[model samples]
Target: MWRGLRVALVRERFTVDGVAALIGSAARAALDRGETTPARRAVRAAGAAGALVRLFLLGDVLPRDEVAAALDPVDVDEAVTAGLLDVDETGVRAALDLRPHADAGLPDAPPWWVLSDLEVAPGGRTADREHVLGTGAASLSLARATVRRPVDTLLDVGTGCGVQVLHASGHARDLTATDVSTRALQIARVTFALSGLEVECLAGPWLEPVAGRRFDQIVSNPPFVPGPPHVEHVYRDAGLGGDGASALLVGRLPAHLTEGGVAQLLASWLITSDDWTGRPRAWLGEAAEAAAPGGLDAWVVQRDVADPALHVGTWLRDAGVDPASPEGTALSERWLDWLAEAGVHAIGFGFVTLRRTAPDVAGTVVCEDLRQSHDDPLGPEIEAWLDRTAWLAARSDEALLDERLLVPDTVALERGLVSTDEGWSPVAATLVRLDGPQWRHDVDELGVALLGGCRGHLPLRDLLDLLALAHGRDADELARTAVPVVRDLVRHGMLTAVA
Candidate 1:
């Protein structure tokens, strides 16, 4: 049935690009924003594809004959029996939210369809306990942030509807998806079957299903919501109090990863004080001690932070509860009170990337806030980060200085200019990266001169000696001071060692 449905979808050109062509970009954008009226209007005259669009994407009731025509090879009776559609005297409607998805980050990757339970409209009733989620912002963010190099095997923990598996298929050789909810696993099966991809599905919580087994890469957008120790929705709440789900994965996932394996996860942590990294840092430290002698290299990037009230309200709305309603007010009060008692002033949402290192090597843990807008895919940057950090870890100051270095074109030196009586003068200089994290570093005259001399032509030691001579400073002292500064630049990709 799934094969037949796949064929029919292909025959009808029910794909991401195909749908966009049928409906204008404006309608597509509106659909992404959760408004389907524009799409319904645009596809009103569209033909068989239009019928499918209306029935499936827009959640509209279409004439039975029209839906049948749209899904030609697969009979309407078969579709209904397969639980893909519902038929009644009024018309036929989609039983599931099946929509075309193409990884915009991977342009050459093939398009696929995702199958999951329908989304609840704003102010609609709350979702069921086991509701399977479709492609959402969290999943898309993890997809863009994942390091997508070719790997022997990949595992997606909490594989809700298998959207991440679809994104991983292009690079990973073997795929496995695990979910605690059997209903989600079932829906993920349908999603994979319809896309003509094979993935092993296991039902378990966190890393239990994959215990004692390791993979090259592991990715998850788990149920990381922080609240009371109760499960309201299996798709969001983990039934563990106060961001325990995120900590659980961070602690245990390293052991389930192969040597040099990488795990990318979307997680949320509680912020009790000004030290936002405190919780995550402790989690990584504990995980490192438990994993192996080599430990784990971790990078936690906090993308957003929300106060307790706003966080509670946001999640309440997500659960289809109106904050203005009496029920919403009661729930919000209880949740906020719980947070206050627990000393959770805010909630931090971010990406956690961990790499299992060799037993002989020490691991690096970096925690920082990066709330800036990133328009491009972060996979390359993340991969480069791991590589750069590894390179820095393997070298000493003397070894690093002996090597020549060059700055990539992506690194630009921006000068802050102020209008003076004579002319515009440079007051401050900052090094800005045009790509990946867009890190900016303030520099002084010596820092600027040092970087200027790094042209991949001479060793850094020689360049530092020249700078010291020009500035009338001791070469040994300058080198000692410059090593750490150069290491920071290299760690952030502003400076590259010439090879």
Candidate 2:
């Protein structure tokens, strides 16, 4: 029956692109926004595909003849027996949403049929406690951020509907998915079975199911929504206090990671002070100290920050509750009160990547706000930057100054000019990376000249001599001043040396 259904979907082109084509992008987007009118109209025009979509995706009742004709090889009666449908004299309605999903970055991979809980309507009602989540923006974001390099084993924590586990199956030899909800594990079982793969779907909170074991990689899009203390849905609410789920997962990563292993997660942390870096800095310290080999490298990129009200409202809408209503207002007040009691000024949401470094490698933490759009599938870019950072951090000032450096093609040296009553004066120069993380570094004029002169043959000593001669500065003073700035460039991957 499953094979027949797969064939029917393939023959009908029932995929993400296909749906977008049938409904047009506007209506397709409307579906995401919980407006199904335009989508219903558009899917109706899609013929047999429309019938199948209506019966299965929209949870709409379709004519018996229409469903039979749409899925000829696949038995509709078998679908009913499997509890996928409830058919009557008039038509059929799906028990769940089974839809085609494909990752834009993973074009070589086949499109997946995802089955999970239904969405809440715009009128804003919350989901059931046992709700199993399907693919959403955050799910896809973690997918794109996940480093897809092949690994020996992967541990998927809080594997709701098994989206991350499914992706990890492609590159991981041994895959294990853990969740506290039994229903989630059941959904994960079906989700894995649909993908023609196998996984160990264990039942436990976080890593309790896989105690005393280390994984080459661990990926999770856990229940990270910060809300009031009372738990409504297991899929989004951790039942832990005030963003504790995120902190717990990140802090425990060190104990679960093998040497040089990496863990990535979509998390939100509370900011209790004016300095945004304070919270993550403390988390990194705990994670590193707890990790085996006693060192971990951390990169935390904050994508957005929501104040108390906005945070509560955004999550309320996510849970399908309208914030404008009396119930939603009360819920918001409770969550806000919780935040106030905890002394949380704002909530920082972002992607966190932690790596258990080799014994000789130094522990480091970098937390910064990058509140701008970025390219997807950033894993490779991030891995390369981490390697560069580790290499630069390992170098002493003398050792760093002794080596020749080359500026990458992606980096452009720009000079900032200040216009005043006097002629335009040079204020600053920066090395701007146009791709990847979009990093920029400030540099002095001599530093810029030295970086440009780095043709793989000139060392820092040679550059200092040239700069001192050109600017009439002492060589010793120039080296002392320019080396630190050059080191920063090296750390950020603007400057590099031959391997």
Please report the candidate that would top TM-score against the real structure.
1
Question: What lDDT score is found at residue 222 in candidate 2?
Answer: 88
Q: lDDT per residue, candidate 2, 377-481, as tens digits? A: 677766776777778778877888788888889899788899999989989987898777778887766677787788788787888798789989999988888
Cα-lDDT of candidate 2: 0.81
Residues 141-225, model 1: lDDT tens digits: 8998999899999999999999999999999999999999999999999999988798999999888898889999999999999
Q: How many backbone clashes does candidate 2 have?
A: 1
| lDDT of candidate model 1 versus the reference | 0.90
Cand. 2 TM to true fold: 0.91
How much does each candidate deviate from the true structure in C-alpha RMSD? 1.8, 2.7
- Output the number of the lDDT-best candidate: 1
Error of 1 at 463 (Å): 1.5
Clashing pairs in 2: 124-320
lDDT of each: 0.90, 0.81
Clashes of each: 0, 1
